[model samples]
Target: MGILTSPIPIQAIKTLCTNCGVRDLCLSIGLSNEDVERLASIVTQRVKIRKGAPLYHAGEPLRSLYAIRYGFFKTTITSEDGREQITGFQMAGEILGIDAISENRHACNALALEDSEVCPIHFPQLERLSHELPSLQSNFNKLLSREIVRDHEMLLLMGNLNADERFAAFLLNLSHRMLSRGYSPHAFVLRMSREDIGSYLGLRLETICRAIARLREMNIVRISGRAVEILNLDALRGLVAGCNRHRQS
Candidate 1:
């Protein structure tokens, strides 16, 4: 695997550095002594990306694997028609760019939606580290598996989900993901723009706006520009669950 430059903070990547969002996830999962050292050696702080910054573009040579440190990123690929297909969103503690592991180039472009930081871990050194650390080998396997599943779900959503269905599902999934990361699932700002959300959900930008307004009318959510609050989470869940029945109808 070719290594690319990273944008994580140097301080946060230092071993014994307790500031990394993925520390608990990375450390607690499994790692060997040698693996830890090799991993640490290649770990470099990434350049901080402001909102709308390009972390890397499609067709760029893959140099390193990346882990999001803070904020959100939207990954997309351009089609033959030059249309953009939103592939996925990356959050803090989540790994991005699995395709580069084998492909040697970024298949999709990773873009920051807010001021964001990424940590680049050199892959060749990481391969050696994983060989020495059995737990790390297992950890790598699990991460790739999850990436496959996520891609499958994205494909399904893009092909089959309708406008309202897409909105409800996105809100439900986003809330659950944030809650897993110890963030306030209900009272969080949407760092991604409506257009990006539309791209991912395969809906029109106006449809995304209208859906958010409808949620507010139902008293299920409160939206003020990018800041969104799930005012009644139970009601929101009900709306999402209602999608299956609505689809059946």
Candidate 2:
């Protein structure tokens, strides 16, 4: 277990959605200025989580849904035998703790991969606000739908793809997401370690290392420790497609 720290108090400060950098990608999207102000009211506190510390633990009662203001996080679940399975990696502008909506307790643990800050939205207040704000309700529904689609995609990725293909898909997926967040798609740093990535992808650490070497040999990517630069974006995408390219128009 990582060392836990108390959340820094910020009663004097408030981060409003109108001034937030990631508002376009977050809940403020498609919302009126008034709606955003209403949201800002409920999001009264911002909590900073230290690296390696959990934002929330599994089976803990869900009090708030977190909007990641900065940094990276990984969600995982532990089995009865104490085997931990990485469920997903989340980044800035993404929401966490949605999995607890049905059970009222977190099904997985959320931990910061680096020093992070999150705006905690109290669940009950959000529910009442959503009732009055149709746009908020619609956006919340979309968030839920997106989670379901992501899960289905992961199932397909693990079930149908070979190791190499899975590795390619993972890189391409990361690239796309980074691009969406206004980061360079061709080059980026990996926040999670290779072992953490393996856990998420259901591959061995050695297998991940080999995949990196194989990509380098093919002149498709350049990897130096945690930094990765895709040398041939099209070639990398083709790797993910594999034989399926022949079937597509």
Q: Evaluate all candidate structures by whole-model CA lDDT and list the values in order.
A: 0.74, 0.86
| TM-score versus the correct structure, for each prediction | 0.85, 0.92
Worst 10 residues of 2 by lDDT: 4-13
Residue 209 lDDT, candidate 2, scale 0-100: 87
Pick the TM-score winner. 2
TM-score (C-alpha) between model 1 and the true structure: 0.85
Model 1 lDDT, residue 127, Cα? 81
Q: List RMSD in Å for every model shown.
A: 4.0, 3.6
TM-score, model 2 to reference: 0.92
